[model samples]
Target: MKKSLVLAMVLAGFAATSFAAEPAFLADRHVARGASCESCHGVKAPAPGAKVSSTACMNCHGSLDKVAERTKAKVPNPHYNHLIGTDCQECHKGHAQSVNLCGSCHNLDWKVP
Candidate 1:
Protein backbone atom coordinates (compact mmCIF):
# COMPACT_ATOMS: atom_id res chain seq x y z
CA MET A 1 0.00 0.00 0.00
CA LYS A 2 2.80 2.45 0.89
CA LYS A 3 4.67 1.66 -2.38
CA SER A 4 1.57 2.33 -4.45
CA LEU A 5 0.98 5.66 -2.72
CA VAL A 6 4.58 6.70 -3.27
CA LEU A 7 4.39 5.82 -6.95
CA ALA A 8 1.20 7.84 -7.36
CA MET A 9 2.80 10.82 -5.66
CA VAL A 10 5.86 10.64 -7.89
CA LEU A 11 3.75 10.50 -11.02
CA ALA A 12 1.64 13.42 -9.81
CA GLY A 13 4.74 15.47 -9.09
CA PHE A 14 6.13 14.82 -12.56
CA ALA A 15 2.84 15.75 -14.17
CA ALA A 16 2.60 18.92 -12.14
CA THR A 17 6.11 20.05 -13.03
CA SER A 18 5.66 19.33 -16.71
CA PHE A 19 2.34 21.16 -16.90
CA ALA A 20 3.54 24.14 -14.84
CA ALA A 21 6.66 24.96 -16.81
CA GLU A 22 6.60 26.39 -20.32
CA PRO A 23 9.68 25.23 -22.17
CA ALA A 24 11.85 27.71 -24.08
CA PHE A 25 12.06 25.67 -27.28
CA LEU A 26 14.72 27.64 -29.13
CA ALA A 27 17.00 28.04 -26.14
CA ASP A 28 16.57 24.40 -25.17
CA ARG A 29 17.31 23.26 -28.75
CA HIS A 30 20.49 25.34 -28.80
CA VAL A 31 21.57 24.00 -25.44
CA ALA A 32 20.92 20.47 -26.60
CA ARG A 33 23.26 21.14 -29.56
CA GLY A 34 26.07 22.43 -27.27
CA ALA A 35 25.31 26.11 -27.72
CA SER A 36 26.02 28.18 -24.64
CA CYS A 37 24.31 31.45 -23.80
CA GLU A 38 27.49 33.35 -24.51
CA SER A 39 27.77 31.69 -27.91
CA CYS A 40 24.49 33.26 -29.05
CA HIS A 41 24.77 36.44 -26.99
CA GLY A 42 28.45 36.94 -27.87
CA VAL A 43 29.35 38.16 -24.39
CA LYS A 44 30.68 36.73 -21.15
CA ALA A 45 28.03 38.59 -19.19
CA PRO A 46 25.10 40.05 -21.05
CA ALA A 47 23.26 43.06 -19.64
CA PRO A 48 19.82 42.66 -18.09
CA GLY A 49 17.13 42.69 -20.81
CA ALA A 50 19.79 42.97 -23.50
CA LYS A 51 18.69 41.48 -26.83
CA VAL A 52 20.72 39.42 -29.29
CA SER A 53 21.64 41.26 -32.49
CA SER A 54 20.85 40.21 -36.06
CA THR A 55 24.53 40.40 -36.93
CA ALA A 56 25.24 37.74 -34.35
CA CYS A 57 22.65 35.46 -35.97
CA MET A 58 24.09 36.20 -39.40
CA ASN A 59 27.51 35.21 -38.10
CA CYS A 60 26.23 31.68 -37.69
CA HIS A 61 23.24 31.51 -40.10
CA GLY A 62 24.96 33.38 -42.90
CA SER A 63 23.94 36.65 -44.62
CA LEU A 64 20.43 37.94 -45.24
CA ASP A 65 20.68 36.93 -48.89
CA LYS A 66 21.43 33.36 -47.92
CA VAL A 67 18.54 33.15 -45.48
CA ALA A 68 16.17 34.65 -48.00
CA GLU A 69 17.35 32.16 -50.58
CA ARG A 70 16.71 29.32 -48.15
CA THR A 71 13.19 30.54 -47.44
CA LYS A 72 12.38 31.57 -51.00
CA ALA A 73 9.58 28.99 -51.12
CA LYS A 74 7.64 30.61 -48.29
CA VAL A 75 4.89 33.03 -49.26
CA PRO A 76 6.18 36.62 -49.15
CA ASN A 77 9.63 35.39 -47.97
CA PRO A 78 10.23 36.80 -44.45
CA HIS A 79 13.96 37.47 -44.95
CA TYR A 80 13.17 39.73 -47.92
CA ASN A 81 10.97 42.09 -45.93
CA HIS A 82 11.81 45.64 -47.01
CA LEU A 83 9.61 47.40 -44.46
CA ILE A 84 11.39 46.21 -41.33
CA GLY A 85 15.07 45.48 -40.90
CA THR A 86 15.99 41.82 -40.53
CA ASP A 87 16.12 41.53 -36.75
CA CYS A 88 16.56 37.95 -35.62
CA GLN A 89 15.25 38.62 -32.14
CA GLU A 90 12.15 40.20 -33.59
CA CYS A 91 10.80 36.73 -34.36
CA HIS A 92 13.28 34.14 -33.12
CA LYS A 93 13.14 35.01 -29.42
CA GLY A 94 15.43 32.90 -27.25
CA HIS A 95 13.85 32.99 -23.81
CA ALA A 96 10.32 34.02 -24.72
CA GLN A 97 7.70 33.03 -27.27
CA SER A 98 8.56 33.96 -30.83
CA VAL A 99 6.16 36.10 -32.85
CA ASN A 100 5.76 37.12 -36.46
CA LEU A 101 6.03 40.91 -36.25
CA CYS A 102 4.86 41.16 -39.83
CA GLY A 103 1.57 39.61 -38.76
CA SER A 104 0.89 42.79 -36.86
CA CYS A 105 0.41 44.62 -40.16
CA HIS A 106 -0.01 41.89 -42.75
CA ASN A 107 -2.14 38.78 -42.87
CA LEU A 108 0.69 36.49 -43.89
CA ASP A 109 -0.28 33.80 -41.34
CA TRP A 110 3.31 32.67 -41.03
CA LYS A 111 4.46 31.18 -37.75
CA VAL A 112 7.59 32.76 -36.40
CA PRO A 113 10.43 30.45 -35.40
Candidate 2:
Protein backbone atom coordinates (compact mmCIF):
# COMPACT_ATOMS: atom_id res chain seq x y z
CA MET A 1 0.00 0.00 0.00
CA LYS A 2 2.83 2.41 0.83
CA LYS A 3 4.56 1.70 -2.48
CA SER A 4 1.33 2.26 -4.37
CA LEU A 5 0.78 5.57 -2.61
CA VAL A 6 4.26 6.73 -3.49
CA LEU A 7 3.81 5.76 -7.14
CA ALA A 8 0.49 7.58 -7.35
CA MET A 9 2.03 10.74 -5.91
CA VAL A 10 4.88 10.61 -8.38
CA LEU A 11 2.55 10.15 -11.32
CA ALA A 12 0.35 13.02 -10.16
CA GLY A 13 3.33 15.31 -9.87
CA PHE A 14 4.49 14.45 -13.39
CA ALA A 15 1.01 15.06 -14.80
CA ALA A 16 0.80 18.45 -13.14
CA THR A 17 4.19 19.47 -14.50
CA SER A 18 3.27 18.37 -18.02
CA PHE A 19 0.07 20.39 -18.01
CA ALA A 20 1.83 23.41 -16.57
CA ALA A 21 4.40 23.31 -19.35
CA GLU A 22 1.72 23.74 -22.02
CA PRO A 23 1.17 27.38 -22.95
CA ALA A 24 -2.13 29.02 -22.07
CA PHE A 25 -3.99 29.56 -25.33
CA LEU A 26 -5.92 32.61 -24.17
CA ALA A 27 -2.75 34.40 -23.20
CA ASP A 28 -1.28 34.11 -26.68
CA ARG A 29 -1.36 37.43 -28.58
CA HIS A 30 -2.65 35.77 -31.75
CA VAL A 31 -5.58 34.33 -29.83
CA ALA A 32 -6.33 37.75 -28.37
CA ARG A 33 -6.45 39.08 -31.92
CA GLY A 34 -9.37 36.65 -32.54
CA ALA A 35 -7.49 33.60 -33.68
CA SER A 36 -9.17 30.49 -32.39
CA CYS A 37 -7.58 27.16 -31.50
CA GLU A 38 -8.83 25.84 -34.82
CA SER A 39 -6.83 28.52 -36.65
CA CYS A 40 -3.74 26.49 -36.01
CA HIS A 41 -4.84 23.22 -34.41
CA GLY A 42 -7.45 22.25 -37.03
CA VAL A 43 -11.06 21.30 -36.13
CA LYS A 44 -10.36 19.18 -33.07
CA ALA A 45 -8.28 19.74 -30.03
CA PRO A 46 -5.11 17.79 -30.55
CA ALA A 47 -4.28 14.89 -28.26
CA PRO A 48 -2.11 15.85 -25.35
CA GLY A 49 1.39 16.65 -26.60
CA ALA A 50 0.34 16.68 -30.25
CA LYS A 51 1.87 19.46 -32.36
CA VAL A 52 0.25 21.82 -34.83
CA SER A 53 1.43 20.95 -38.32
CA SER A 54 3.26 23.41 -40.62
CA THR A 55 0.55 23.09 -43.26
CA ALA A 56 -2.02 24.45 -40.83
CA CYS A 57 0.15 27.49 -40.21
CA MET A 58 0.77 27.98 -43.91
CA ASN A 59 -2.94 28.08 -44.61
CA CYS A 60 -3.10 31.55 -43.06
CA HIS A 61 0.47 32.58 -43.53
CA GLY A 62 1.55 31.78 -47.10
CA SER A 63 3.00 28.89 -48.98
CA LEU A 64 6.76 28.22 -48.96
CA ASP A 65 7.08 29.67 -52.45
CA LYS A 66 5.55 32.95 -51.37
CA VAL A 67 7.74 33.15 -48.31
CA ALA A 68 10.87 32.42 -50.29
CA GLU A 69 10.03 35.13 -52.81
CA ARG A 70 9.43 37.73 -50.10
CA THR A 71 12.71 37.06 -48.38
CA LYS A 72 14.80 36.45 -51.49
CA ALA A 73 16.67 39.73 -51.17
CA LYS A 74 18.05 39.04 -47.73
CA VAL A 75 21.60 37.72 -47.91
CA PRO A 76 21.31 34.01 -47.24
CA ASN A 77 17.55 34.20 -47.16
CA PRO A 78 16.37 32.54 -43.99
CA HIS A 79 13.33 30.93 -45.55
CA TYR A 80 14.99 29.29 -48.52
CA ASN A 81 18.54 28.83 -47.26
CA HIS A 82 17.53 27.29 -43.95
CA LEU A 83 19.10 23.97 -43.03
CA ILE A 84 15.75 22.58 -41.83
CA GLY A 85 13.66 23.47 -44.91
CA THR A 86 10.34 25.31 -44.67
CA ASP A 87 8.99 23.90 -41.44
CA CYS A 88 7.99 27.13 -39.69
CA GLN A 89 7.68 25.55 -36.26
CA GLU A 90 11.35 24.65 -36.38
CA CYS A 91 12.00 28.33 -35.60
CA HIS A 92 8.65 29.80 -34.70
CA LYS A 93 6.51 28.89 -31.70
CA GLY A 94 3.14 30.57 -31.27
CA HIS A 95 3.15 30.08 -27.51
CA ALA A 96 6.85 29.86 -26.79
CA GLN A 97 10.13 31.56 -27.55
CA SER A 98 11.07 31.43 -31.24
CA VAL A 99 14.51 30.14 -32.03
CA ASN A 100 16.95 31.27 -34.75
CA LEU A 101 17.82 27.97 -36.36
CA CYS A 102 20.57 29.65 -38.32
CA GLY A 103 22.43 30.34 -35.13
CA SER A 104 23.22 26.67 -34.98
CA CYS A 105 25.80 27.11 -37.76
CA HIS A 106 26.02 30.75 -38.80
CA ASN A 107 26.62 33.83 -36.68
CA LEU A 108 24.02 35.93 -38.52
CA ASP A 109 22.13 38.25 -36.20
CA TRP A 110 18.52 37.64 -37.08
CA LYS A 111 15.76 38.75 -34.76
CA VAL A 112 13.46 35.77 -34.39
CA PRO A 113 10.19 36.56 -32.74
Q: Which of the numbered candidates is closest to the native, going by highest TM-score?
A: 1
Each candidate's TM vs. the true structure?
A: 0.72, 0.65
What lDDT does the true structure give each of the candidates? 0.80, 0.73
Model 1: lDDT equals 0.80
Residue-wise C-alpha lDDT for candidate 1, range 7-90, written one tens digit per residue: 999999998888556355776667667778787888878788878888877887889889889999997888886754757787
lDDT (Cα, 0-100) at 44 in candidate 2: 54
Q: Which portions of model 1 miss their true places by more than 4 Å?
A: 1-24
lDDT of each residue in 1-111, candidate 2, tens digit only:
699999999999999987666544322756657778888888657566667788987787688778778888888888776363657777777666777888778888887
Report the number of backbone clashes for model 1: 0
Colliding residue pairs in candidate 2: none
